[model samples]
Target: MTKTNAGRFFEDYAPGQVIHHAVPRTIKMGERALYHALYPARHALYSSDQFAQACGLPFSPLDDMIAFHVVFGKTVPDVSLNAVANLGYAEGRWLVPVWPGDTLRSVSEVIGVKENSNGKTGVVWVRTRGLNQHNEEVLSYVRWVMVRKRDASSAAPETVIPELAKVVDPSDLVLPKGLHFDNYDFTLAGEAHRWDDYDVGEKIDHVDGVTVEEAEHMMATRLWQNTAKVHFDATVRPDGSRLIYGGHVISLARTLSFNGLANAQMVVALNGGAHVNPCTSGMTVRAWSEVLDKAETSVPSVGALRLRLVATTGAPFALRGEDGKYLPEVLLDLDYWALIPR
Candidate 1:
């Protein structure tokens, strides 16, 4: 059996392809600790075993985004290894809550593919499902990536772009079953900002930069049970460079958002996001967010705010394009919706 290169080309992907990306991940307490340190996430469901037990779980689970990354990271090898840009994501939902010890594996089915007219790139859309050790579907979502063509001179194929939602409706939000917070401790949760405090168009700068280390990411990947060759086994890469798991950057940015957006509790929607550039070790990550829109929710205590969070390494606050493109040090541009205290 021939192994596909981790740096795959656009010409290599086809519609209806089912890619069972390699490596399985299992979440653990160390990863949980990192979550606590990375973000000021103090939800009782994730912070206390006693609280989780009262909530009917034996132990607290990792954050939902952590599970999302554990599952999404696996698809990088097959879906976006050679991607020019991550186009967008849509219809994402977390079906089941992930526990600390749950082992996760993901499978992505290619739903659409379109070659570019320029003949240098193409787009690939895939619906990915994250399954736990018990084979239960934990989360699922549709993501598309713009992939570079290995042979740019080839004729372009028929275009097939898929339609996607601009925002996931509040009714579409899926709260973990039994996720009631009658006794929710606002103190331990950190910060007093609630759903009503944030206004649309407001900007918040999360003032902290976590300097990443190879060992830190390696430990994180291992904690999630994500053993992708590029993420861990350095010898497998031609350049012998270990690719920092994109999830690490995502988590770092999300965690960093806690400073001013601490009340932006749950991530209700992921409209779009991009890991614009590679993040190597020793890069210090800093994040800032702008509230795009605000919406009322049935949960009166919390309102929803649409935000764009930017993560950068060494780049100063506020993204500027000298050449009309994102600065080289900019690591990510993410658009999402979060539940904030009302």
Candidate 2:
């Protein structure tokens, strides 16, 4: 049996280094089916091949987050093997739409490396680029992580911290080329929301719930090749329990919002995301969304809407601020940008 190359150590990276992550992944219809069932995603472009062609796509494409997971998973082996924490992401942009059969690969370049003042851990920033079979850059983002040094006795390296954006500018979000909904099918799109229909303060409670299972999450984690012991292998944790991947819940909530937010496609800006509580197998996950802000994209054909997508465990319906902050059922809070049809 072959051994797994999960992640790298701090000593293995250097500034200006470029790592081409391997294991190209081909998105399939089965993945699409899992996506739909996982989050109740109803976007015509990702729902039916027939409906997708009507929207000018060659075929149904995988969900955007799925593309992100595949690309990010590959970098784990070369970048975050001994990571203490994932600091943040910025300047993210999706350049191309991912089709069902497209093979995806990733390459990351070390943008900066700095030794922390404490001398025990350091920060590493890398720009990961996702590409398709034709070598087209599908998506790119700058992410940083805190890594621990194996030998604290060694002297610190150069202190060259890179300036990072606190929040990705809404104006910089890239719209997928040729993505216009001039003739967008509202019926198949599964929503009547038009570009002008949303208000800056509009709140939408996407009513849907999914009961997560150990087998389901394990399959997803293995599919992404994210072998973080806490996410799998229950024996590694003191509690003997597997921790669900935060990204899995994020994708779940984002997809569930599709019922009434189908036109709200293309995640442009990821403001911030948090997994409030630990999620385990057999937990029923529910979701709701709130329109925090809205902006016009340079893409004359679409509008950018910033939203807060929330995921809750053990709930069967949407969220309502009954006892003050997100109800006790809340499990996640994610802020992101989506491009909607104009």
Candidate 3:
């Protein structure tokens, strides 16, 4: 009898199956310090307790991505241990701010699955939710991954693709309790631009780039407890190169956006995202953003801006080609809503 656990394969999943992922993590300032070191994240609201208090938060909470990564990491063992690729995401929303000392865990429900014609692999869609120790739901999203079958001859499961929302309605976005940006300080935040300053369809080149490093990426993957074999084991890929985690690119692009969008503080919702291309170490990642739309929130001075953040290895602003396919140089395309001072 084998004592070691082998993660779920495509055939092992069924619609409506719920998986309780293991290993709850207690977040602390150490994680925050390491996160800042790994990525160039310097949002004022997350940087200073005074700054966050000024904006009506109790104190500086953990970076939103920290909570996201922690929750995502917890799901790896059960959800994507045998994954070939993490396909995409949709209808994600952050319900509560994660404060230090909070313990977080994750649970996922198998919402959909489809057998690929190739027979060797299939796609599994799961809706995952992150909850704190109090069992309060903090973050939720739907993600699909391509996973290999334990046996090529295994029978395929009935295809069931979930009908996911194309976008999270603005009215459904959750605002952090007491999070009013009425007394926002542009000088301290590093950018004077407000919600009114940005127009729809406006694009901004962040004008910065960071070369992905093998050591840094490994440390980051370990920090988040992401154990996907392709991210750490070079042997997993045919070329013997460890693939960069998609979340790493997402965080890097979000950090890079601070150059011109410093005031766009908290990410309230993730409408959709795609990892258009795989990234590897030694490539320089650059980021750019386009304001998709803007809307007023119920908060006194807080507004929401729908933005598309793009990560690329090539020139800035080049996205899909004439044929409606992602350009070879594009790495990630993410659509989300962020809170900004009005």
Candidate 4:
């Protein structure tokens, strides 16, 4: 009997299967410190306990992306160990604030699967949920990955692509209890722009960039306990380059976004996202955002802004080429809702 995990292949997945991922992670301030060190995340609500209290949270919660990475990392071994590429995301939401001492684990249900034309790989769609120690659902999202087939001769699975929501409705957004941005301080938050200041279709160039290095990327991946072979073992890829975790690009882009959107405090929902291109070490990452739409939330003091966040190494704002495919330089395109002062 094999003592180690060989991981699941494309043919191993079937619709309606439930997988309880291994390992539960206890998020601590140490992880917070390391996260801050890894990215230029300086959002006020996540930075100061006093600030978070003023905004109605008892204390500063871990960064939203931190919770995301930790949860997504837990699913790597079972969901994406043999993945050739992470396809896309949809219908994601953060239901509850993750405290520093919270222990988080993940569970996933295989919602859809389809074999590729080449028979060398197939797409697997799984809806994953992150639960705290008390079994409360904290975060949830649907992601699809292209996993390699162990044997090309294996029979292809029946195609069952899930019809996911194109966007998370504004009314359905989950806000942390007592989270009111009425008392939000513009000074401490770093930017004076409020919800009313932004107009739909308006674009903002964050005007900052970070050069990512392999050392730091690997360290951050290890911090989340992600065991994806492609991220660690360079020999797995024919190009001999380690693929930077897509979540790293997300956090870095969100960090850089602070310069222009400091008051966009909490991420309530993830409408959709795509890793357009593979990012490697040595790329200088920059970010830009376009205000897609704005809506009033149930909380009188808080408003929601639908924003399109783009991470690219080339020019800003040029997402796709004439053919409608994402440009070669684009790394990530994310659409989400963030809470800002009304």
Give candidate 3's TM-score.
0.99
Positional deviation of residue 23's Cα in model 1 after best superposition, in angstroms: 5.7
lDDT per residue (tens digit) for residues 1-342 in model 1: 867465667877767788887778767777778767654455545677776555445567678788887887788777876765566677777768888788889999888889876778899999899999999888888888778888888766656676777767767766556544454556766777766677777878788888988887887776555545557766755677777777788888887887887656567667777777878788889999988888876655456788899999854466658777778888888888776555
Model 2 worst lDDT window (10 residues):
314-323
lDDT of 3 by residue, 26-101 (tens): 9999999999999999999999999999988899999999998999999998999899999999999999999999
Score every model by TM-score: 0.80, 0.82, 0.99, 0.99
Candidate 2 steric clashes: 2
Which pairs of residues collide in candidate 1? 25-224, 25-225, 26-224, 26-225, 194-341, 194-342, 195-341, 195-342, 196-342
Which residue pairs overlap in candidate 4's backbone? none
Model 4 Cα shift for residue 109 (angstroms): 0.2
The residue-by-residue lDDT of candidate 4 on 199-259, one tens digit each, is: 9999999999999999999998999988889999999999999999999999999999998
For all candidates, the clash counts are 9, 2, 0, 0
Q: What local distance difference test score does each model get?
A: 0.75, 0.76, 0.95, 0.95
Q: Report each candidate's C-alpha RMSD, comma-separated, in the order given.
A: 3.8, 4.0, 0.7, 0.6
What TM-score does candidate 1 get on C-alpha atoms? 0.80
